[model samples]
Every structure is written in C-alpha cells, then in structure tokens.
Target: MRFDTRLVHAGHELAEGTGDVVPPLHLASTYAHGVQDPPAYFYARGENPTREALERALAALEDVRFATVFASGQAAGATALATLAGAGRVIVSDDVYGGTYALLTSSRLDVRPVDLADPAAVADAFADPWAAEALVWVETPTNPMLKVADLAEVCRRAHARGCLVLVDNTLAGPALQQPLRWGADVTLCSTTKSVAGHLDVLGGALVHDRADLHDLFTTHRTTTGSVPSPFDSFLVHRGLKTLSLRTARQVETAGKLASALRESPHVAEVRYPGLPGHPGHEVAARQMSGFGSVVAFRYRADVAGLLRRSRYFADAVSLGGVRSLAQCPATTTHRPIPPDVRLRLGITDDLVRLSVGIEDPEDLLEDLLQALSPS
Candidate 1:
C-alpha cells in the first residue's frame, strides 16, 4: 500500500472488547503470566500490548524488522550508540544536535568530530589512528544548519571498514527519508518532533533491518529501562496517522518562507535544502521525497532586536511541531559547544532555525516582515 494509506491503517484494528476503531491503550504495568511460561508480554519494562502495537506499526512504516520506542529521543540515541560502540570505542559524528553531542562527550565513548558533508574527510577520520574500534553516526540535513550528508557513500565506506552506521532520521523523519534503504545499519528518530505532530508527548524510536541489531536494541531497551509509556506510545501512533499530510503542508510553508527570507534585505542567508541554490539541494533532492519543514536563516541586522520585535515566531526550543518556533542556535541549542567549534560547523551567532507550522503562508510572511523591519 502507499505511504499515506499505510499511515492511517497500518497498525490499528477494531478492539476485541468494544469494537472501537482505535487501538486500546493497555495501561497496566504488568501482564498476567500462565502457569508454565508467559506469553510475549510479562511486564511493562519488557513490553506492553499498546507499546508493542505501536512498535510494530513503526517498524512497518520504516520497512524495518523491528522497532523499539524510548522515553525520549536522547534515550533512543544513547541506546543505539551504546549498542554499536559496546565499550571503549570511538564514534565519528558531525558536530550537530546539542543533545547528541552532549551524550557522546559525557559518556566514556571516544568521539571524533568530522565534516559529514565531505565524504573524503569522513573516510580520513575513519582511517585515523583513533578509529581502531569506531562507529559512524550521521545526521543528514543536519540540525540548525540543514547541511546534507551523503549517506550512501558514508555507509559504503563505514561498512567496508566493518563499522556500524547509525543515522538520525529525526530532521527528515521516516515520511520523507529512510536511512536503512541507503545501507545504514540502524535508524534513530525523536518522535517528539514531526512524528508526534501535536507536541503533546516526548518519545523516540530505533528501527533496523538486521535481525541481530534489532535483537541487540531490544536487549538494550530491556536492560536500560527507557521504554515509552503506554499512553505516549498511543499518542505517537495517533500522530502518525496524519504524518504525511502535516509534513506536506509544512514543506510548502517552509519553502515559501525560505524563498522570502532569501529575498529580504534583513536576512543575510537562508539555508534550506528546498531552495534551488542551497549547497546540498541536489543531494537532498536525490535522497528525500520532500524538503522537510525546518528552515535556517541568518539576520542581516540586529538579531536580538529583531527577535524581540517578532510576534508570531516564538523564541523557543524544539522543532517539528504544529506551532511555529524560532530559535537562536548559538545561544540556545549549540551553547554547550565552543564558539569556535560552532563556527567551524557553519553554525553562526545570527543563525535562526525556524520550525514552520501548518499556519497560513501570508500570516507567517507578515510576521516575519514586521520582525525584520525596524520599529
């Protein structure tokens, strides 16, 4: 079946007890076990019916063998990285996404920062002396900057070196891009964003094509005890039903906003894959079905003053929600990383990451213009 059709009817069926159209939420923490041996579910930590149903649906959506839901995106990321790295191993990653960066640096795992957009640099990093037991973690159309990485090339190189490849599919979400199809061993996503749509729940998931990796992630889920609650899982499933529709509208709005920002005198630069002249436009066009909902732009004048004057764009954290949000990465998201390091990664002080919502295009444009203009 097509993606949109699958989204609405993939994992849900009529309830056995009431014949309800929606899947019933099993909130009980523990399930009854038989005398000899229990069925698939024994306890909430291990599995629950509601969570399992959502997991199966997500796996089907991503075309993966298994899917494990987590309490948050960071938990899923940590679990996947820990499973791949084991212990006392190096991880090569692009200097993006503050939460992921914190996890990599805080843990005992050794991390090597590299320019993911350049395949040659990634290859060199993998061949370096510190790469003895290394894994490659990539985030395409990377956070804040919207820099696109060549996933297929990187996966080929990493696999050739007997290394695991983990791609964070949060920014593009599974509706637009699937990393496993590009040869990635595992795909990670923060359902709190586009997948949840409503911004009402915080959740994460890991999908993989390999059975061994799937089993390993499942083991990690059980040991780490970071599985999502039954209600959160249900909400994620409900949000998934409208994923394609919401994303399609968001894409259209983001494209218009990016184009308008580029033409405005108060904007220094607009970074969006959907834009014709964006550096990674070709790569994104090849890999993703849609250009996604996020757009980043730099201010030509007083950034602080403009933000203060802005009425519609809320200066807030997190993206991929139904509400539009504007954030200053240098101060909010990427503050933990050094200033020089952020600059090296092409994340500037004036950069404003805009998460376009399903709002009217004209209203959003007017708000932006008023904010950019001097009061």
Candidate 2:
C-alpha cells in the first residue's frame, strides 16, 4: 500500500465483535488470562492492543518490520541510547534539539558532537579509536538550524567501523523521508509533533527493520515502563490518517513563507532545504520527497517585535502542529546549550524558527510579511 493508504488502513483491522472501522482504544490495565491459555497481551505496560495497532501503522509507514511507541519523545530517545549505545562513545550532530543535547551531555556516555552534514567530518570521527563500537546520533535538517546530514554516507562509515547509526526522523517524519531506507539502523521520531498533528497528544516512536533490536527495545520498554497511554496511541493513529494531507499543506505554506521571507529586507538569511541557496538544498532534494514544514531564518529587525506582532503564529516551542507556531530557538528550544556553542551552530538570538501549519498560504505569507515590516 502507499503511504496514505497504509496510514488509514494498516492498523484498522476490524475486531471480530464490533467491526468498528477505527482501532478501538483498549484501556484495560490487565487482561484476563489463565495458565492453560496464554494471551498475547497480559498487561498494559508490557503490551497494549491500541499501542500495538499504532505501532503496526507506524512500521508500515516507515516500511520497517518493527516499531515501539513511547510516552514522550524524550523517553524514546533516552531508551534508544540506553538500550543500544549504553556507556559506549556516541557521536552526535553538533546542531540538534535542545532536549537531545541535554540528554546526551548529561548522561555518563562519552558524547561527542560532530558535523554529520560534512562527510569528511563524519569519516574523521569514525577514524578515531573512540569510534570503535560507537553509535552515531544524527538529525537531518537538524532542529532549528535546518542542517541536512548525508544519511547513507554516515551510515556506511559507521557500519564500516562496526558502529550503529540512529537517525532522528522527527523533522521530516515518514511522510517526507524514511531513514531506514537510507541504511540507518534505527529511526526515532517525536510522534507528538507531526505524527499526532493536533497539539493535544504527546508521543514518540522508534522504527527499525532488525528483529534483535526490536526485541531489545520491547524488553527495555516493558522493564523501564516507557509505553504510551492507549488513548494517546489512538490519537496518534487517528492523526496518521491525515498525515500526508497535512504534511503537503504544511510544506506548501512553508515553501511560500521561506521564499517570501528571503525577499524581505528585514531577513538576513533563510534556511529551508527548498531554498536554492540553503547548503543542504541538493542533499534534501535527493533524500526527501518534500522539504518539510519548518523554516528557520535570521531576522535583521527586532526579533521580539516580529514575534509579538504575529497574529496567526503563536510564539512557542515545539513544531509540526495543525496550528502555526514560531519561536527564537536560542531562547526556547536550544537554550540548554551554552551561548558560545549555539553561536557556533548559528542558532543566534535573531534566528526565528517557524513551524508552518495547514493554514491558507496567502494568510500565512501576509502574516509573516506584516510581522517583519517596519512599524
């Protein structure tokens, strides 16, 4: 099945009793099971019918064999590292989500940041003794900065060094790109953002093709208790039905907004893979079906004023909601990073990150134009 068709129908198998079109939310904490007959699901923490359904759909969308849902994006990310990478050295993209940076740096693991977009830098990282049996953490079209990593090249280098690669597929989601298709061992996504669509639910997912890795993640999740609630799983699964449609609208709005922002004198630079001048434009074009919905740019005018003047966009953290959102990453998402490091990554105070929603293109464009205009 195609992406959208799989989204709507993959997990919607009719129950023998009710024959409901949607997957029923199984809220049972524990199932009735006897020693003589073992059930597939015995407890909510270990297994949930609703979560299983959602995982099936998620796996189908990514064209992977297995998927595990989590309570939150951070939970999934932390679990991926703890279960797979452990105390071993981990090489991550220098420009990544603030939560990711915090989680890695605060952990006992030897976490090193490398420019994953640069093939030479990645090769050099793998050359080091520390890279032996190491894990590579990559974020393509990286958070806030919009830097795209060459996934295939990095994965090849990591595997050659007997290392594993985990690609954060949150920004692009399965609608735009699938990292496992590019040879990544695992793909992590914050289903809270794009997958859930609405701002209501918080969830995360890990998709991969390896059966052994799937077993490890499943065991870890059961032992550590990081599974999502049945209702959240249902919500995310429901959101999947409209994933392609919503993503298409968002990409259209974002592309228009990026082009318009680039023409404005108030903008210093625009960073969207769809933009011809963006460093990762060619790479993103090659890897992704769409450039995604988020747009990052350096604003020359009062960053505070532009945020305050916006009517359609809410100045907030997190992205990929049905509602448009905007924020200065230096102060919001990437604030956990040190001042110098943020500057080095080009996440300056004037850098405005906009998460375009499924709004009318003309309205979003006008809103940005008026917000960036002089008073």
Highest TM-score among the candidates is held by which one?
A: 2
lDDT of the candidates, in the order given: 0.85, 0.91
lDDT of 1 at 353: 90
Q: Write candidate 1's Cα lDDT for 244-285 as tens digits.
A: 989998999999999999999888889999998987899899
| 10 residues in a row with least lDDT, candidate 1 | 86-95
TM-score of each: 0.95, 0.98
Per-residue lDDT of candidate 2, residues 167-258 (tens digit): 99999988999999899999999999998998899999999988998999999899999999999999999988898999999998899899
- Clashing residue pairs in candidate 2 are none
